[model samples]
Target: MTNSIKPRLLLEIIAVGILAFAGVLTKTAANVAFPAMMAAFHINLGTVQWVTSAYMLTATLVIPMSAYLQRSFTSRALFLSASLFFTVGTGLIVGAPSLALVLVGRVLQGVGNGIAIPLMFNIILMAVPRSQRGMMMGVGTLITATAGAIGPTYGGLLVDRWGWRMIFIALLPLLLGSLVLGLVTIYGERRPARQPFAFLDYGLLALGLLLILLAQNGLGEAAPLVSLAEYGLGIICLFLFAYRSTHTATPVLNLAIFKIAAFTWLALTYFTTFMVFFKYVFRPTQ
Candidate 1:
């Protein structure tokens, strides 16, 4: 029984790992095409970078809402829907003849990727035994790091060989395979639905994303200080979000999670670690 259970558990881990890898793949696939996109669209680097920036902006804004969605929908349903959205978005980008359509596709991809990432974490927590949680987390970290290490090089090679559209094409099979596996192996677990959604909080999140987009567009060699201001404004908006989330009845984020001392300390530690790692990884001189 123990031997049989081990193999089944390994299969589950692989399934989740593949799904998580798809998310990283989507993010990295576009890196090589960035320059091509700018040249083809006749847009400046700052404007064209929105292809990446918009995805990130949308992801950041939408992630907080995933808690509510998770409450209402099954994991299988959420995973399937997110995968479909990502796949559709990639298809659109592959076929897009115009810049506007490309941007639209990227926005959709961002939303899908955003929802999928946190859901992956949730899946790991729920599926793995407590005794093995640390091991699973280590596995996840390794997968993420491996993806990051290779993504840029791989993307560059693909773009050099096949052009920008090829990146989108590359993702289709992976997404389809993951979607099928997710449906077959992942069971739906239900939870009570969240109460009526709050419109104001949603609006604020949208505004914050817009501000981030603006900041990303504005910040470059041509206008560094102005871009900084735009980014600063976005940070302010995030603080506003925190305040509103705490005060409102139908908050988008559950502030109650921080009430636990362990949760709070862990969150702070994670934030610090993330900051250090990110700075080291992305240092300008490097």
Candidate 2:
């Protein structure tokens, strides 16, 4: 909320970055332990895949709600809640006996990450002036995404040394530190107002997004017709959500922002590079 760099604001951003790091870190960290988890839980590969799939799907479904969440809650409250979710989630996985509990923990962590990632960008956009936003985002992105690059290796080392549970245990201190720092640094919002949540819009968006992703995940597994039908329905739901956003007084998400060419372009670049490239493009199989 300042034109110039402020210590308090810097600290707040740091707190947000920590949440991002933990979220991304946990995401990839869990990957390296799938085999171990399978053995521990006596599950098959498809079932074990749900460990990551569930977390990712939960995160994806929760992401669209970020706009609604930020509007409804304070920055501090959001940050604190995010940190707490992750910390609690970590604790669950650290001692979880069944695959079900581990999935529950991952989903909780996903919720925290979904809330935290967008909240960081929201802060930079609202608090930092346009002149400084790019630099701030660069710093924020680097800090947040760094954990992803190191996560597998970090997890491998921990799993090698102390077993899969150590991966979660290792994160406990950082998550706790982020929790305390967020409480001290983030103050809900600069100014606050109450607005009713747009449930129908959220429902449409969440359903559409979930269907689309599920279709993708079901590729090569389900009948071709089923996947196509799911994908088609997802598109229809999204179209209705967009139409409602334009027609209604208060849609959960402001789809109108895509009208801005620069923003839309940047969004597409991010989508293709992060969401599509590794997963779809350049894959050995079609």
Instruction: Give the top-scoring candidate (lDDT).
Output: 2
Write down the RMSD of candidate 1 (Cα, Å): 3.7
lDDT of each: 0.73, 0.81
lDDT of 2 at 254: 81
TM-score of each: 0.82, 0.88
Write down the worst ten-residue block by lDDT for model 2: 277-286
lDDT of 1 by residue, 1-286 (tens): 4213255456555665665676566565566577787778888665666676667677777788887888878877777778777888888999998888888898888778777777777766766777777777788778766765666667777888988888778878877787777777767756657568867777776777687778766655688887788778877777787788898887888787899999999999989987685444332110
RMSD (Å) of each candidate, 1 decimal: 3.7, 3.2
**Candidate 2: where are CA atoms >4 Å away?**
1-3, 129-131, 188-191, 276-286
Q: After best superposition, candidate 1 residue 145: deviation in angstroms?
A: 3.1
Clashing pairs in 2: 1-127, 74-188, 75-188, 76-188
